[model samples]
Target: MTKPPKTAQTAGGETHQSAEDLGVDALTTNHGVPISDNQNSLKSGTRGPTLLEDFVLREKIFHFDHERIPERIVHARGSGAHGVFEATDDISDLSKAAVFTKGEKTEVFVRFSTVAGGAGSVDTPRDVRGFAVKFYTREGNWDLVGNNIPVFFIQDALKFPDLVHAVKMEADRGYPQAGSAHDTFWDWASLMPETTHMLMWAMSDRTLPRSFRTMEGFGVHTFKLVNAAGKASFVKFHWKPRLGLQSTIWDEALKLQAADNDYHRRDLFEAIDTGDYPQWDLGIQVFDEAFANAQPYDVLDATKLIPEDDVPVRLIGTLTLNRNVDNFFAETEQVAFLPSNIPPGIDFSNDPLLQGRLFSYLDTQNSRLGTTNFHQIPINAPRCPFGNFQRDGKMQTKVPKGRANYEPNSLADHGEDGGPRESPAIGFSTVNAATGTDESGDKLRVRSESFSDHYSQARLFYRSQTEAEQAHIASSFVFELSKVGLLEQVPGRMVSNLLNVDEDLAKRVAAGLNIPLPMKAPAAKEPIDMEPSDALSIHKNMKATLEGRAVGVLITDGTDADELAAIVEKVRKAKGKAVIVAPKVGGAKLSDGTQQKADGQLAGTPSQIFDAVGIILSEDGCAAMLKEGAAVEFVMNAFGHLKAIGANDAAQPLLDKAGVVPDDGVTGLDSKFVKAAAQRFYAREPSVRTLA
Candidate 1:
């Protein structure tokens, strides 16, 4: 009999048992070679670069990469655009990368996507949004790949496969696409306390973005910027939207899925097509080793974040997507982003998740694009000069001019000037000073002790939110957990984990599900109360402006032309889009006997997609609108969604029919409507919906 390996408890009190002890098949390579340590890759030391010889990782990731044919395993559903990154501030003190040179303009491609979904999934799902930018720098292509949320669910890269697998559609049923509110996700999350922080973000309004242009983007991992003096400063990248932060209500997000499958994609395309370029100010938080050492949590831990209050973000550049994709398949689909594609001055951190990503993304591109020559694709190719001696892989597109395939040869005499000889001064170099704790030591597969305080930031995020936002989070929890059927213990187990975040939050979720409160999950490190960051709250940081917003104008037959024109003018002047909605796709006859052309039809364009609504109906038009279900919903949904509604006196009957309550956001068709349309009425949420 094979003797079973021993089981030990982690600091979190979760018992990790061996395969034999768990009565499960041993995890092995594709060739059936036994994997002794599947949880961590082989490295020179615990906090060191992953060794190239880790076949377990290679096999697992290699297989995972090709799981879907011609589609990404994650971030498959994407919307991309051509852009230019303009360096607005001089950051020569920070890095030598020419992309950071003042007044320098770098062509860029930005891909925004949702994780845990297929290419066929709807755009408006409650999931982490990928924000990856490929900067065609003078040095090289710099791929600053990240997400909308600042923090990730797990610390180590080894757990990435598991985390993604759990959140993906369950294998047996292959259902619940593009969403985390399912049995497999909760069951896995209930056991892993590290997921708590990101779960908070995923459940929040952050996931339900109003537009791709409005959401914030984060690097999620600490990186290094090497100055001309070889001075290294740890940096976190941020993309602050020019339009400001905006999000939809949970109900509004769901309705948007039904209203338009490609809501975000279409919005992005139309905005760019109409010369409304989406812009984001590139910001960076620069810190030193001393400041990093002083933090309560490790900066290398991907699950944690350094609040903007602690280290304020410095705006350095602007990212503007001014052009839509010419071809979706050739440009958007084939564009590959590799974490390894860093410019000379930019370098990696010892972030475990980042380390794994550095290794996996290149392989992913190869698998998806079906060749080693993926860089030959115009979208992924760098605009800067590039050459190498090595050549001829599958689908080799470039032609090498000379016989200089190998390095360290006197091949210049053989009609070639030794193709792309190494230039140490001009090329990329690594800062070799000690950074991570125990940079080199024994080859042990271990989780960092510094990464154990999982619940502290989670608690901080919850406490930071406003009361209304808190209720949305709690309600989101209830809605997600209620989907965890058959796994009866999972909901309670997840609630226990939530108890560690906040007892009130746990109780609210428990009450929402009609379940008794469970004891708090054991802490790996006792969670300490951290200071609440106003920057973390979407509502607190939201900009109250109509710019980049879309206002739907509901007009019917015999609608007041003067009122319609006034409302449209106000919206345009405020830099907001005015989309005319009517009973028919064609023009609607107005009071002035002029035909009012509509941007969308009543049944097709639901109120959920718009920021605010305006109803300009005559008495007969109101009667006609009241009889139509779409018109009634157009008003009801706007009210239910907490959007500003401006209606003419004739539209009062339709408003009353839709159960519209009078609030600050509910105003007559006047100047107040434009002001009110600029923001959402959060106070009215409680009356409109039953939140946890």
Candidate 2:
């Protein structure tokens, strides 16, 4: 009487249950017989190609062949990982979403992707990243599908397909894969005045983020959260990088594409493998309906952004990616996400872009998943229990055992119920709202006058950038526009558009293009004047930590062992990585008679791939390195890129050979330069000669 375990009870409420007592048998074939040969498909001949006649073979191969659905038109190239999201703080009052209530630990899957690339495209492309997350909660799965940038190109979802078409490679030529600096994009962007603000972002360093971990994520459209009390609050979701914001120079980004196409992927995998898990703080720009109505622009406009100064961000939780996926196809590729897949407490707004997204995601999945029951895929399946009366679709796995299939059946009266009862009181309920309608219904398909002022935020963004960043932006514009070999078709149109943002920027771009500047900018609602938000500047927000950063260590035949060891130890202590490059790929002999293996040969590893570099040599080794053009260029390129250079007394002649001068970031005996090396050298870039 004192000793019956919970497992001792049977379905009949008897106290004599055992593992061998009663239950369904193990999994079996489709006919409910048994499955023993799942590993091997039956074939007439052992070494022959797969047989088509066998139903088991056909079933497995058909599924495997159709396993790969079409990749997304945008964000085709992606990498993902599995992790756990532990809620550090409680915001139950604001949102009843179980993932963020109290100290709940939710399992999460995150996919990071490039916007304009194919499945086989390079990882370091200059493009916006899709930062989408799936959280498994007790209620259901909550998908926060978002992008790295906060603002979008168009204000309405109606324009999304056209925007994507323009940016994609031209249908006829089929060239310029994963690029936007082509004629079609420029033409469409010049015609669409609303695209002006986002064009600035696309041209800026944000598009050339150094890594996925260092960038921020945003739920580009506004959303709503309903608390337990049924009160709704307007919310804009944000994912702020714990490492702060950082980006690579355009030149460095181009070089990296050739040197290491898998740069970001390798960095992510290694970081997790080394226990340096990437982390981002979850923040929200929460507001009330009153604030949305008081805004100058339409809150539903996807092209607009709520300034951080106007509405402060609330830090509620942190998302740490602590694990990597075991298999890419099983986990990342099969993972399906839709913005419409929200939990009970979370809801969507009337944002046009979001509304369109809700439909587009499902439509795209049909082609990608190849079936209506795509949710049955393990990666996309809900962990919580689910039941429905609907059945008999392609690849149906469940079998309902009952005589009655519909609800409210007479079979239930005979104790043979065939359906589950509905819970209307505890189910999802849409909040009813009424617009000021006169007769027919709520009017649609019209933009409010408040959405017309496009230049104010654009100007604020420009003014907010630091002097170095502003110059980079201007230089980037000049570089991209100059690629438009036809002056009248693209460059002139772009200059005319820039005039609306800033007269001086327009003038400089015109001069660079050798075109006459427009006399005046197109008229705007009010003279664009807004307080500069410091949060908009990436360089200003960048942190001093060198975590996940790399350093190049150059060695020669007579490299000093003590010096190399000390430098490598210091880099490791600062959470930075160091790779040893020797004059030869085989090995390098040290002064202490010790030979160290080279991580890379001088010809293989260029200094452009590292955050900083250090050089050690003997007189003979210096002379040899000077004679080798690759070695000379290694030091020279690092200097030109404004990377911090560390050297010993013997390495002076090599520096002289490379024509490197001792700047503030250059270190000799002291290691103080390590600190400066973490910061990018914006001053030196303008002076460097452009590639001919």
Candidate 3:
């Protein structure tokens, strides 16, 4: 700067040519007016308040103030990605939807969300996840609005609002945001017998999915598939992850919330950006009316599920997410999904909850978007051509040239312009099975008797779990019930309901809470002791591979550089990521006198965020880390969580300080360590912490 150098250092600290020298375009306002000074507001003096005449400041503030729109009522916190859904198997025999034609690729936008959180909520909450996908098909936009869990909390749509209100934060306190471990929720749940089945799933590890890529999705309602000949078959939709199902323990999930608020979102974004595209198989469980009637429970019941043991899932298609959204608010936020957005070949069942959602979603879009023209938004618009008689609503972007706005008009014969008319042959047609009333014949507001047995599946779920998983489920119930401070009886009432599901489970939860076991609650229908289904257990179904997992490498000054590189290479060879954590953000100098950059700082990034951990320390580094609490916690938490731990000889002191006992999962740095790190040593859990 003393001699006015050729390149000047910008505010970002990088030397660059001036805008004029670089021939860059000048900044302009929305109206295309040149903006001379954007750094400072127009003012009477240097320290004066912004002048009213400053149009730039006024415009910017006005737009900023109105930038945010209303968030979704339930699935408020979400992450989305652009993807392609490819038909791998021909399902035209089951349905005539073109998207099911073998080898056909359809553009899709998928959003993964937490059900009971605000837009600013953390990602690792124990809650139901909304898995909604909008397929831009040739016929129209087909939205598959579903959830990670197969069943819901209620049997009928009428109880939906009450369920949501109870789960949400209390109106007076407005506290306990993004959680359902309060008195109001437990009190309401204890009174509603239909919630028993879903509560079991919600309290289990299913609600604590490790990542969206490892979670299973369900349509949550019985639907129908109509063929070209108008023959209908009842179906259930399932999205099975390519990586297999996986979840974090309750303790790990709690710690993850503190380590990274955007854990899921960041994982999705980074995965897509790095070309590690996530994939899922679209599976369908198809059955006829006879099979549906033959089941122990009603197919029309929203609270029930067709066990995989009963009806095998047929793999029909694959969905791969390969791109992150360019603008999150423009694409992910403004996108609207409705259960009513079905293609011609697909139709709905008479499920009471499904019926209510068909009306609720359309009405919600109207109120939230403040216009019926939300269809005009690019994200929500259909890919195929669309036209209608309706026009001139708020935010209308299309200009229609026509004298006739209504259908069944003769304006075309008089040479006046007429809009497009509905197609009779190729357009949408409602399935005959969905058009009539049920055998009851009366339009009464009542739940079907077939939907009454809720505890049988709950028992099936509990008995299906591994011993460790069952203990975790019991502990989770005790933890959540303990948070219900307002009602001491609410915990007992919940335990009483649990008695109908499994007496042992009820006893375990009661013992954990230090409360006396209550008498069994009366069930509308006695629970049948259904054989335990292995498909319902996460541990039984987990893939014994390290692919798509992550590991954290703890390093310090003078650590072996060759060992660090070898560990990272091994992880990459296994299709996993190895992140480096050091004491300082600038990282440390290795034994080879080479500086290596750290992916994260030790204090900020905890071991909970990774599937496994490795500690490579020098003798001096070990001494230094002994006095650091975070270093001790890094090893302690990983060992206590039953995660595989890899360490060098020098790291023994730090491991000893953290009370890490030698186990199968705790291995010295070697080829065997990589394979061991791929799995959680559940046998070591009992030695580390006592479970319910």
Candidate 4:
């Protein structure tokens, strides 16, 4: 098990304590003396000053003072939930991992995180998301730490610190918090050509995922799977969400960040709480060493990707997040995942980034855990039986009864059993297939020739996007590069890199930036004609139902209760959520004199936060709410975001004020209009205004 990276914070107004929740008598001093009081400081007298002789007081206070560890330079802000991964299909031919054996269910913990924000930062930022999972298998605990994006920025680990330094808050001015729109980032990216592939993904809608349930997870590096016979094969891991991929528009995301900072977390929690558990199918792209060597590019390159067309993903298992954490501090915040935690049959490749990760993980754990025995934390410990000769470190809880710690001792065969003997037939064994010898002193740093062509995959990614999605990518580049203050003609430099991807893309981005298009584009080893992969497009695959989605209905004084009840019943039957909003905070009277209070006032809740909007206002209320700025924005944003808007006859003027054309998305709906509002409006979006 690996300790959490620095930057886990106590949420909101909670205090952080380093000790486990085993009570006062359960906790002991560093010198093995039991502690009776952990809640209060020991004093000279009943209410007197704290005494220096009270080592218990000193230990508690001293630990509290240094409770916070350093945050990760990236992926600081995150949310976690407990879940179970169940094997739905058998894939014993691919590997011998016990967790994937037929008809097995294992406990798992997953953490979803945004890559570039503080722990308390808003959830809907434009950034790559982390999708890390830890599985407690029969053999041991295995961690599959990965990101939503299938590829990474650099091919090697040597450029990791440099990449993070550029993306983090600028050195001189610590402004632009939780963002990447700066001169330093573009400057570094424009110079390093390999970043182009991932930049295409980051600029696309994948970075702005609508919900954690809608995004996919990739291992991002090549790995190996060894069978019981010691035969090894190359593999890649994938987690495809059952709901498919979806993302919010940039304008909607910005507004949602202000309206509800916890949008994604709230959506996930409510979905599980309502028994609509989010699920993803575990997949593996299996290949042999001969096939890996036959590839045009190095399979070890982190910046490159193998097209799914070449090696299709085979689904083997499913993971469902069915439970929320009982305590955020003890479980979620303290849970740790490291790539080095691999069960038998699953092994590592020669990817440089992965090699560096093996060393970086344990070292970073020490900084966060503050002790060598951080694994003793229940969340990090394995559920299965585990024992070894090693013992007695800081925070040690176990006490072996005998002194026979050595395995080969003559006194071990007695009742006091010596350490367990190794079983080679069942134990993990490393594969040794290397032909090159280390004693020849042939070690030298060099980039493989197969990893040189970086622009082909970038081109493949761009060309794979739909026309509108490609336009969004170009617009996103324009928006981010426009914020670079010091770099004049930075757009040209970025577009120059894009020329290697596509001439039309370079021209469009250049036009958006008000610059001249390049004369010619660079060429790739394989021409920029890779077949488009449907998995890459968010707009191409959206959920057709409104389950786990929110709808806001605006009401006013003297509104019809029967009509409101009908709409609520229809939405509820579809597994959708509905919240009421009124012109005033305290709400208004209905036709039957039944005074119902609203969940939020019109000024506080905006229509942009919901998937659909309803205006069930009366004639007088419509005229009154139309005069308010928030009400106008509520209706306008809903239409501009291409959401379904159901209105009453009296609400026509509000729709008119919002400049909403009477289309399919704009309907005079009652119980009958529930069906159309559930599906996404891809056709209606083109008629709306493009913010960029």
lDDT per residue (tens digit) for residues 410-452 in model 2 = 7888899567766665555554321221122577767768778
What are the per-model numbers of colliding residue pairs? 0, 0, 0, 2
lDDT for each residue of candidate 1 in 40-123, tens digit (9 for 90 to 100): 889988799998898888888998876645889999999999999999999998899999999999999999999989999999
What ranges in model 4 sit over 4 Å off? 1-60, 405-415, 432-441, 518-527, 670-672, 682-692
TM-score of each: 0.89, 0.88, 0.94, 0.89
In the range 365-420, model 3's lDDT, one tens digit per residue, is 88878799998989999989888889898999998886778988888899887778
Best by lDDT: 1
Highest TM-score against the true fold, candidate:
3
> Candidate 1's C-alpha lDDT?
0.91
**Model 1's TM-score against the true structure:** 0.89
Q: State residue 352's C-alpha deviation in candidate 1, in Å.
A: 0.8
TM-score of 2: 0.88
